[model samples]
Target: MKRTWIKKSLLVILLVGILFVLAGTVYLKMNTYAPSEAALAVAKTGKSEDQILFFEGEQGKPAIIFYQGALVEKESYSLWAQEVAKAGYPVYLVATPLNLPVLQQNAAEAIIAEHQLTAVVMGGHSLGGVMSSRFVSSHLDHAIKGVFFLASYPDEKGSLENFSGSVLSITGDRDGVLNQEAYQEAQRFLPDQTVYEVIAGGNHAGFGSYGEQKGDQSATITNEEQQTQISQLLIRWLENLE
Candidate 1:
């Protein structure tokens, strides 16, 4: 009986050791399987590498998922995302590899599941913001923390209804590319709660990482200043919300 007891104890110890090894191997494998290629392929639906950029942060603040403008790539938004991460908020870029409309929604749901986020605040640059706004309006029951837009229109893609969520719109005062007509039109949807900020000398591409590629030739603010101001504004707004 004593020998049998010893054998069972050894067997249990061996099983536990094997389980630990298996768990460690799975973790290592998952860490090695990055989705850069899958993300790039999704970006090709309209543009490559336009969907998501991941950044490490303080892990308590809600994740900030950025959706880029129609023609911009995901890498172009990394500068702003990195700045947000530095401020202690995790950030991810939302892409549209399969399709902009579908992928953005899918990305949000998938990220929420992966991170176990009960309430995530979503935003984007230009059309990306538009997409996020539309999404949050419909998914408000999911406990979205807030919604923001960088040089993005407020209305839905095909309709006149205002986007759902705590809307924030930022644009450069000197940005001729972001038509004021559209801005005003979008405002009609959010009567009192929307926060619209216009940075002096900023441009339509203020949220992007690169400025020379846009070829507007009229921007008054340096890219660094624009990026900083944008990041600060986002952080302030995020800190104030419920």
Candidate 2:
């Protein structure tokens, strides 16, 4: 009877484990956000080199390497990249492993080695942005001019306070998912002169072309409007910095 009971328990445990694995698989698949209409449009002229999608804008223009959020498709940033490209900056979107930037921390290395850009601005959204901060802080000698964050913050693990480059952090007022308290706390980790902006009525997912996130609030402006504002403001800031 003891042996029979032991076998039954083992079988039950195996079934439970299988169920959990199946559930996790379903969650990951269902959360795969599709690219917006603008993403499809940008795909026409996009170029790929070393697994990074490059929006070739103009020669000698500033190059921006943007990373995608966790579980979010890399091309979900196409709309914004296109706008940045229109502003005469080459935008390179790094494709992360399983759409997780944290898994591939050195994803920017390939882009930097191949692009031959003089001054590079590196950034990402959410988790992606955090890893981007890590890359920039470690690679200060690579001529990194600036770091941008979209609904993201530089945590204590990797602070940007000592970084001699510019920092641009853009957030949304109505973002329900981003940790408000943590965001405020992380401000100390950034440089004193960080250029921070809060978009009125923008939500957490406003920075990307992805669909509505689980806990995100409704954005007052369309994705196009937000992307336009971001690209325009970024270009203006880049121009005025000199």
| Number of the top-ranking candidate, with lDDT as the measure | 2
- Weakest 10 consecutive residues of candidate 1 by summed lDDT: 31-40
What is the C-alpha local distance difference test score of each model?
Answer: 0.67, 0.83
For model 2, how does the per-residue alpha-carbon lDDT over 62-153 read when each residue is reduced to its tens digit? 68898888888777888878878887888899888668889897788777887677878888999988999988877878878888999998
Clashing pairs in 2: none
Cα error, candidate 2, residue 234 (Å) = 1.2
Error of 2 at 163 (Å): 0.9
Off by over 4 Å in 2: 1-26
lDDT of 1 by residue, 1-242 (tens): 99999999999999999999899767644432122333344323322233445776676687776776765656666655666777888777765653244345546777777768875888877767777776676665786777787877657442224435466778877775666797777776553677888888888766675444344446687777887898898888877874
Among these predicted structures, which one has the highest TM-score? Answer: 2
